[model samples]
Target: MKTPQIVELTSTDIDQYIDKLCTILHANVHDGASVNFIVPFSFDDAKNYWKNKIQSSIEKQERTLWAAFEGDNLAGSVQLDYSMPPNQNHRCEVSKLIVHPDFRRRGIARKLMAQIEDKARELKRQLITLDTVKGSKAEPLYLSLGFEIAGILPGFSRHPIENRFDATTYMYKNLAAKFDG
Candidate 1:
């Protein structure tokens, strides 16, 4: 299948995309996807969280949010945040690389990742760092994309309903060299 296109999330797209994202998050919360917030979170709460995300992205020095599209549907989303202080100007953090369950294994997440990496390079960010829930399907994908495992945080996350689970695997990708090109 041809790859879905990745585009910057616009003001109009944020609300609808967040709605779909909340749907995906709701499903995952039931099955346990260590994002943020405990399970049993309402869609309203998710919308509020994403609302802030959109605002933060609009800040010139904060973040850039990207949404993946398959035709007219919102397939997935990701973010590249550069809110580091003066000393850490060269670094950025990636977060919320999520795809709908029906859209998994279709290269949507990779495309989104690529989009953010491109933007990071344009923004002169040399290092990109992020963490994924341990044992999640995305971890291997990240490893394949050249991200190195920096460390693991044990019991760093707890599902309000799942009792307890391993924290997350912190990973870093040296994009400075790649950014130079």
Candidate 2:
């Protein structure tokens, strides 16, 4: 299958992104994946969250939101936040990476990550960090992509349905040396 093409998501893209995020969140809960909420996530809440995220990103002017689309359908997404404190402005944080249930294992997330890295480099960011639920299938992917496990935080989150899940892995990579323009 052809991977979805990544595009920079602006405020105009919030509605579509929210729809996709709701799908992923519902699926994760259905699959018993420990993200948050339960199997029946409220689409309204998801929409509200994405709306805030988009507005915040725009206001901060230090974040980049990228969405992967197959034709007119959203397939996945990843966000890069570049608003570190003064001394840490060279670092970025990766967050809200989600792929549709039917779109897993086809490198969509990898492509998103790569695109975000390119954006980070373009902004002169020197490091990237993110937290993923422990035992997630994404752990291997991150490690394979050269992200080092900074550490693991235990009992970091509790799935409203899954009851309790242990740990969230923190990963980061130095992107400065890898920059090529």
- Give residue 27's error in model 1 in angstroms: 3.5
User: Model 2 compared with the native: what TM-score?
Assistant: 0.87
Model 1 lDDT tens row, 37-117:
786688887777777665556555477788777886677788888889898889899987878777888988888888888
Prediction 1 TM-score vs. true = 0.88
lDDT: worst 10-residue window of model 2 = 31-40
TM-score of each: 0.88, 0.87
Off by over 4 Å in 1: 16-18, 59-61, 178-181
Compared with the true structure, what per-residue lDDT tens digits does model 2 show for residues 1-181? 7758899977665654667766665665566665545546677766666777554775568677888888866788778888788978878999777787778888899999999889988987888999888888889989999899999999988764665766999999888766443
Count of backbone collisions in candidate 2: 0
lDDT against true structure, model 1: 0.78
